[model samples]
Target: MHAISVRRVRRSLPRAALALVLAALGAALGPGAAPAAAAGHAEECSTEAGPYQKTVERHLKLTVDGVQSAADCAAIRTLQTRHGMEPATGRAGPETWRIVQYERAVADPSALTGCPHGTRLIVCVDLHRQLLWVWDGDHVATGPVPIRTGKSGYATRTGEHRIYERVEKQWSELYEGPMPFSQFFDGGQALHASYRNIWEEPGSHGCVNLRYDDAKRLWQGLRLNDPVYVWGTRGP
Candidate 1:
């Protein structure tokens, strides 16, 4: 009877261990796991607060008043993500805001016009709109970039000209300043990257001042002897 009792006790011990292992696994992966995963998903879907949030919110409100849907915001976020802007977790940070503003400015009707017919490669500048665009035949290759032309006494010349030279890093002898990625199409004036803010009201001194990145892209796209058309008059 004693031997029988010992065997029964050993069998019961194995069952107890199995039950303990199951309970430990249940505690680890039971109710808490779902909530944690749900929280992570929520974070993935939501935008984080940041410096440019207010600006983004204001723009959205103005564009679509009384709308609770986040469609517009999401669209902007999607664009930001595609561009690899930071905090692409559906948030409009500084990088995203800057890009959005640039795009809006570029899309202005005054900035866009048909490239001259029969032109294979052309750089089109609209002084009235303060914009520059690169055209490959009929299709736009680059730009609608914001630019700063000459201000006040110094006025940018308007006409059809050809790119005479390209200097990757040029120092302006006249202005005593750096001009990166300069494509000179006319005498004493070129399309070059500027240190000054291109968006500012008062612009450069006769040279077409482009943002650095835009200048680089323009430099890459334009070849020597490419035609450049500058139109629109300086304000009186």
Candidate 2:
């Protein structure tokens, strides 16, 4: 009997020590340091909520519940649908978040940091954000248009440039393709309309491709010698 009691105490000691260690770890990591599954779920909800929280409250004119409730998710789905985003299944992911970020940046005047100071009627393209905006002094004339810039090997050049030539319908001699409303700013590279889906990944060969309507708008607004600023790098 004495031997059996001693063995039981030894077994219980390990269990008690494990519990104490777990408690200490939990305390160090804080309340958010839940079990793995619980922590993962929390992180997912947080990622889904981050980009659209303010957008939902301010622009979508809906309630923001940190994406914790069904109603909040539904609202986000509706917004995504309106914006033409695919798989609008009330689940916010990277692509959906990107669109939200772009919209928010367009609406915020302070976000136009790429536009040079004292320059009026400028074409600003943020490669990292993948957005284009036509700035007329303090006002935005016509953009926040989604654009596809040069892909990996042929990254678009940054810094200030000017539209040196404009052609309503230009043919790409190098690629033997149609480049409508071509506005050349950097060598053969131009800003033009591409029939391919601009939102689709792995963008242009070196030119900045805009949607048909946006290209038309830009063609009408931009003039020769107007500053065209392209900045930032395409993010991974």
Largest lDDT belongs to which candidate? 2
Worst 10 residues of 2 by lDDT: 1-10
Model 2 agreement with the true structure over 27-118: per-residue lDDT tens digits: 78899784443321211222256444654544566665455356666666776667765445555554555576678876786776766645
Candidate 1, residues 116-224, lDDT tens digits: the string is 7345878988776566887786667787776767877767888899988888978765556778898888876788887554443455678888878999999888889
**Residue clash pairs of candidate 2:** none
Cα distance off (Å), candidate 2, residue 186: 0.5
Q: Report the C-alpha displacement of residue 165, candidate 1, in angstroms.
A: 1.4
Q: Please, what is the TM-score per model?
A: 0.55, 0.64
Off by over 4 Å in 2: 1-76, 87-94
CA error at residue 15 for candidate 2, angstroms? 60
